[model samples]
Target: MTTELTDAELLDAFHRQIRLSGREDEPAPGIVRDTDGPVARRYPQEPGTSYCMIESPRGLGDDPDHWIRRQVDFFTGRGEEVEWKTYSYDEPADLTERLARAGFVAEDREALLLGEVEGLIHDVELPPGVQLRQVDSDHDLGRVDELMRTIWGPGRDDGALTREMRADPEALDVVVVEESPEGPVLCAAWLRYSPGTDFASMWGGSTLPQWRRKGLYRATVAYRAQLARDRGFRFMRLDTTPDSRPILTRLGLRHVADTTPYVLDARRGA
Candidate 1:
C-alpha cells in the first residue's frame, strides 16, 4: 500500500502526526486546545519552560493577542519559562507580532523541512579519517553533551538532550560522527519517532566549529533518513538552522514552513 502523497498531503500528514502527537511521545497527554489553543506542555516543570503549539493560528480564534496572553499566564503562573513557537504559515500571519508584544523574546527562526525516506542517499563517505555509527552508550552521550557544553558554553544545559533520552532508548536513534575511534567527537545528531505515525523528526544535528564545510553533516542526515526508511517510516521532518537549511533544501526536502521560538525566561523576567 505504497500510496504517494501530494505536498499538501505531506504537510497535512505532518500536522496530524506532529502537531497532534503529544510532544513526541512524552507522557504528556492529548493536545491542549482549551482557552489557549492547542499546545503540548512539558511535565515535571523546571525553572524555565517551553511547549509546542499543536496547530496553526489563522482561524484558531479572532484575537491572537488575547489567546497568547492566556497561554503566557498558563506558563507564567507556574513560574516556568515560556517559549511560544510560531510558524510562518500559521493562520493570523501576525501571530509573531502577538508573541513579541506578549514579552516573549524571539529566538532563531528555522526552516521546517519534510522528506520522503525511501532511497535517500546515505552511502556518502565521511572525510578521510572519520567514521560514522549509531550509538546509545552513556559514554557517547556524555561525550556529546560535553561537546555541546563547549559549543554552547558552560551555561547551556541539556534540555533537548535530557536524561530522558538515556532513560528511554527506544524513543531515540542517535548518530555521532567522530574523527577517530578514540579521538574527540566531531559531531552528533539524533532522531525520534512517534509510535503510530508516518513521521520521524531529526534533532540536534550540529558539527563542531572547525568541522563545518565538510560532508559529515550531510552524511549524518542521510544516515538518519535511511535508518528511518529501513524501519518503515514514510517521511522525515527536521527544523533546521540557516547553515543546514540550504543543505537540506539541496537534498530535495520541501520547505514546508518556518518556526521561531519566543521565550519568556523565568530567571530573566524575575
Candidate 2:
C-alpha cells in the first residue's frame, strides 16, 4: 500500500525533486542547459527563450542581492529576454522586490498546484457531443496552435511550440476536446512528463468562450491524469491561474506555493 503524503511533504518533494533539480526533461535541438550557477538555467538558441529556474537564494550565501543584480545584467546585456521564475517560499524574503529593483517586471502570479494521480484518476462525464483525444500530427498541432491563439490572443506564436513538439513528441501528450472525431477543437490541453521524475505538468486547458462551464475543462484534466498515472507518474502539477484555482481545488489539487515570472526584456531598449 502506498502511503499518502501531506501537502507540505508534497510541496517539498516538488521543490527538491523537480524545481531545483537538474534537467531531466530533454532540451530541444540548439537549447543549452546551464547549471553553473546556484539555479538551473535553460538558454534556448533564440532570444526571448532563455530562462532561469530558481527555487531559492540560499545557495548564493549571504549576498543574494548582488547575485540578483548580476543575473539581471547577464541576461539583459545579451539582448535576450529571460524569465526568472520565483516561488513564494523561496529564501531571503524580499526576493520579488529585489527582482523589481533590478529591472525585472513581475507577471501574473500563479498557484503551484499538486495532486495525487491515484486521487485524480476518475471518470469525468463529458457533455453531449464533446470528446477528448490525444493529438500529434503536424496538421493537428497546427489546429492546436490556432485554438490557443483564439483563447490567449492573436499575438501568440506557434513556432516555438511546434519546434518543441517535433524535438521530443513522446515527452508530451497534446489532448483536445471536440464535437466529433477530427471536428472543431472546443477545448484543448497537454501533459508534459518530466523524465525520471514522479510528476507530470498540465498545460493549456483553455476552452472556446462558448464552451465554458460544461465540464470540458475537468474532462481534459481527468483525461490527462489518467494518462499520467498509466505512465508511472505519481503526481500531477499545474501552474494554475486564479480562474482555474477553485476548480482545481475541488478536484483535490493543493495549492502548495505561488510562482511569478519576472521578465527582463533587454530587446526593448536595444
Candidate 3:
C-alpha cells in the first residue's frame, strides 16, 4: 500500500508541486509571468482581472512595500484589477496589513485544506432521487450560473469559468448534484487539474440553503475526489470557510494554512 503522506509532507509538496509549477505553466485563457516579487497573472479575456501569487513574502527583502507598489503600478497602469493572495505561513507576518496599506481590501479568510485523493476516495450515498453528473454544454453551464446566482445572489460572474471550460474542456470538470435527473441543482462544484503536478484543486462546492445539513456538499466533494483519484492525482486542495472546515476535516482533509485575498480595483482609484 502507498504510504499516506504526513501533513507537513503534504504541505511541502503543495508548495513544491503546485505553487512552483504554477510559475512555469500558463493556465488557459491566462498568462503567468514571474516578477521580482510575486508571480503575476493576467486574464486577457477577463479584461481588468489579474492576480499576484506570492509563494514567499520573505523574499521581498527589507523594502517589501516598494515591491508591492511596483506590482500595483505594473498592473494598475494598464487599468487592471488585481488580487494579492496572502497565506498564513507567508513572511513579514503583516503581509495582509501591508497589502491593505497599499490600497488593497482584505477579503474573507479561508482555511487552505488539502487531502490525499486515495484517503478521500469513497462513495457518499446521496439522498434518494439526487443525481451527480458532470456538465459541459453551454446550456448546462447556464444551469450552473442559475444555481450560483440562486445561492450567492447577483454580481457573481461565471463568464470566465464557462469560457475556460469551453477553451480547455479536459483541464476542468464541473459537476452538480440535482434533486433528480430533471430536478433543480442542489449542489455544484468543480475540479481543476493542475498541469505538471500531482495536485487537483476543488472550487465551488456550494449548496442551496435548503439543501444544507444534508450530505449534498460532502457528496460533491467525494464525487470530485474520486475523479481526481481515477485520473492519477494524488492530492486534492481547497480553500474553504471556517463553517465548512470541521466538515471537511471529518472527511479526511487537513488544515494546511489560511489564505486571504487582498484586492485592488485600480479603476476605482487606489
> Which 10-residue span in candidate 1 carries the lowest summed lDDT?
27-36
Per-residue lDDT over 51-163 for candidate 3, one digit per residue giving the tens place of the 0 to 100 score? 43334433467787888888778667767676777788876787778888988888899998998887676677878878889988887777888888887886424565687
Give the per-residue lDDT digits (tens) of candidate 2, residues 1-270.
Answer: 989889899987887777667533347666777653565566766665534333343355588777777677766666777777888888667888888888888999999999797777667888876778888878777778888887787642365457778888888888989986566689989888887889898988989989999888988888899899999999989999999999889889999888898887776665
Best by lDDT: 2
Candidate 1 Cα lDDT to native: 0.71
Instruction: Order the numbered candidates by lDDT, best leading.
Output: 2, 3, 1
| Model 1 bad stretches (over 4 Å) | 1-4, 23-37, 49-59, 159-162, 268-270
TM-score for each model? 0.85, 0.91, 0.88
Worst 10 residues of 3 by lDDT: 50-59
Candidate 3's TM-score reads 0.88
**TM-score, structure 1 vs. true:** 0.85
lDDT of each: 0.71, 0.78, 0.76
Residue lDDT tens for model 1, 1-270: 577777778888887777755444344222233323544444344433334332343334666676666767766676756566677777677777767787888888988888787635556777887899997777777777877787777543454455656556677888899976567779888888776788888888778989888888888889998888877888988888887888887887888888787787554557
Cα RMSD of all models vs. native, in order, equals 3.4, 2.3, 2.7
